[model samples]
Target: MAGGKLTARSAATTKPGTHGDGAGLYLVVSPSGGRKWVYRFTWQGKIRMMGLGSADVVSLAEARGLRDEARRLLASGSNPIEARREQERAEAGKPTFGAMADAFIDNKGAEWRNAKHRAQWTMTLREYCGAIRSRPVDEIDTEAVLSVLQPLWLEKPETASRLRGRIEAVLDAARARGHIPRNEANPARWRGHLDKLLPKRQKLTRGHHAAMPYAEVPGFVASLRERDALAAMALEFCILTATRTGEVLGARWSEIDMAGKVWTVPAERTKPGRPHRIPLAGRAMSILEKLAEGKTAEFVFPGQRAGKPLSNMAMEMVLRRMKIEGVTVHGFRSAFRDWAGNETRFPREVAEAALSHVIGDKAEQAYRRGDALEKRRALMDAWASYCEPPASNVIKMRKSGGGSAV
Candidate 1:
């Protein structure tokens, strides 16, 4: 009776409409009259049951095969229930590339100086690393990284190289944290690996410096002068004084001395961390005077909103409207240096001092203590004259030892 096959009618008669097969393996009849095959077994000293199949779908022989397989696994010291659970857990533990990248950025982005730099780092990763975004971080290999970087490598080498380094860092972090198995060789590294494959980036073409020629400056200034009631005046003032964009934009009324004709930028705002004394030229003073007229605010160029200086973009936008391309507002300092070197006879020290540039040798800076304000005053006057429309008659000027025009 244990081994014999019984017809459904005979089993039903013997069981009297009760719902289970006689053996440990059973066909349970539900209220709806559907029969399902289930097996009860012991694995690792614990009782367990595995559903073999629906009796309607699986033949008796097929259900026996499934039951035998489950029993064999249990007999071999494997807990079938636990094994299935672990398989599911392993699948869930695998992290997507996007998830890993976000983790990497969150951990590393705080080291950057500002929000702009942090934003750039994340944006590049999101844009170029899209292919592997959903792929498991543990499974990402050189080929996977290559698929993301290869297309942009030649066309945008700098961006591609940056993307590669960031991707490598993310994977390396994952590896260290046991999220992945090992430190996979970064496909993006240029020195030993990628450099062998791609053409080297030009060293000279690395950074952006937007400077304009000195010869074209007079015409540019003339064009700027024709524009009215714009931040072009402040930008032009910045050029005449040989100061920075931030210095001009954030300039307060308190810093300017109308009697002394000097603008002293505080040490905090200056790049060199030393207070800079700019000898205000006649043209620069004139512009400041115009801005001060009818303006009751503390800032010379106040923002449309109260208590704030002018927006940083205001001056740059003014330059763009003037149709002057390839020249940054900050690069005007370079233009001034070129003019001082080529057109005028001002000493290198005086010109450099005018730009608030830190000079060589700390000993020299300690020894040369004089600010040379009067001398700078005359030099600034000459610069202002040059910026103005040239008269038909030329005037010869002599240079003084203190860097003033005689």
Candidate 2:
């Protein structure tokens, strides 16, 4: 304990140690700067320290009053700390967020496609989730998750989005392992949860979007094919090619090479501002062919305007049309990424290039300048097949009038 009695000013500035007051009341600052008020006293002839509250929340005067109460109880041969414990009846604490995150990485890290994946998880949890790292996994609520996200959510949207996803993943693992109650909804959940609170992430992302779980994409694709709108086709095309919304909407016939089975997105339309050559999957080719016939406009998915491409909100409207909930058009890229990373054997570089993300340090990026087109083509093909509509729900696309349910 520090030798001198602490005033409010000294207590706030005190370094990591126990700062004392006159009669067993103290402010204990941990190495991480977490300060708590404690009442040090004798309980049943053994020394005991009872937590009053966090120093941030509890005042020195209140702590002194609590110390006085403890002294009163001590004179009466009662242990104030044990009495408080009995009154509170606190639950046994579960594993902390940091410990759970460490376990999650150790268990799931091997399944990740790249070594950097582990590093990303580790760094995000350690740096971004520091507020909740010491909190029990079960104790993490929406407020706690929001505390970690709200500050970074705007300025560093990409990092904030990734950190939220990682937190959700660890909490999900905790739930599945029975660390949390089975019926408890995850606080870090994005759709219908955090999306309701934070700024719309679509406008903030750098072509990287919040993802729907990959396992549900195929079913969602099947639902999309049932619609007849051009916007529906555009959304499906975005998924099949694993390209961004603007890239899919802004595509022109000139960019498509039917013979080569490729679509060359010009530098202007891409996220990285570099021309990207995407090999067409058979499903994607079919989508192009279906949209091509009886097509009079230059843009693949044209708006009602004289020569303009489809409005960016068109696909989002398609979601509303279908009454689909909790999914976004750009999120398909993330779903595609998740599928490639976890379910496929394709190397991480191929998947990254397919998404137009120029990963790796400068030299590694320079060495990987080829874009790994053919390898990515294979990966895209596999992903396309994975997203194939269920046979029972197939709605054939007629060349003239769009999709028909017959």
For all candidates in order, the CA lDDT equals 0.69, 0.77
lDDT tens digits, residues 94-136, model 2?
A: 6778889999989998998765566667666764575577677
Worst 10 residues of 2 by lDDT: 397-406
Per-candidate TM equals 0.47, 0.47
How well is each residue in 205-289 modelled by candidate 1, as lDDT tens digits? Answer: 4443366666556666776776784487887888799787667877889999999899998765665656789998888888988
Q: TM-score of predicted model 1? A: 0.47
lDDT at position 327, candidate 2: 59
| Best by the lDDT measure | 2
The deviation in Å at residue 129 for candidate 2 is: 37
Model 1 CA deviation exceeding 4 Å by range: 1-208, 390-406
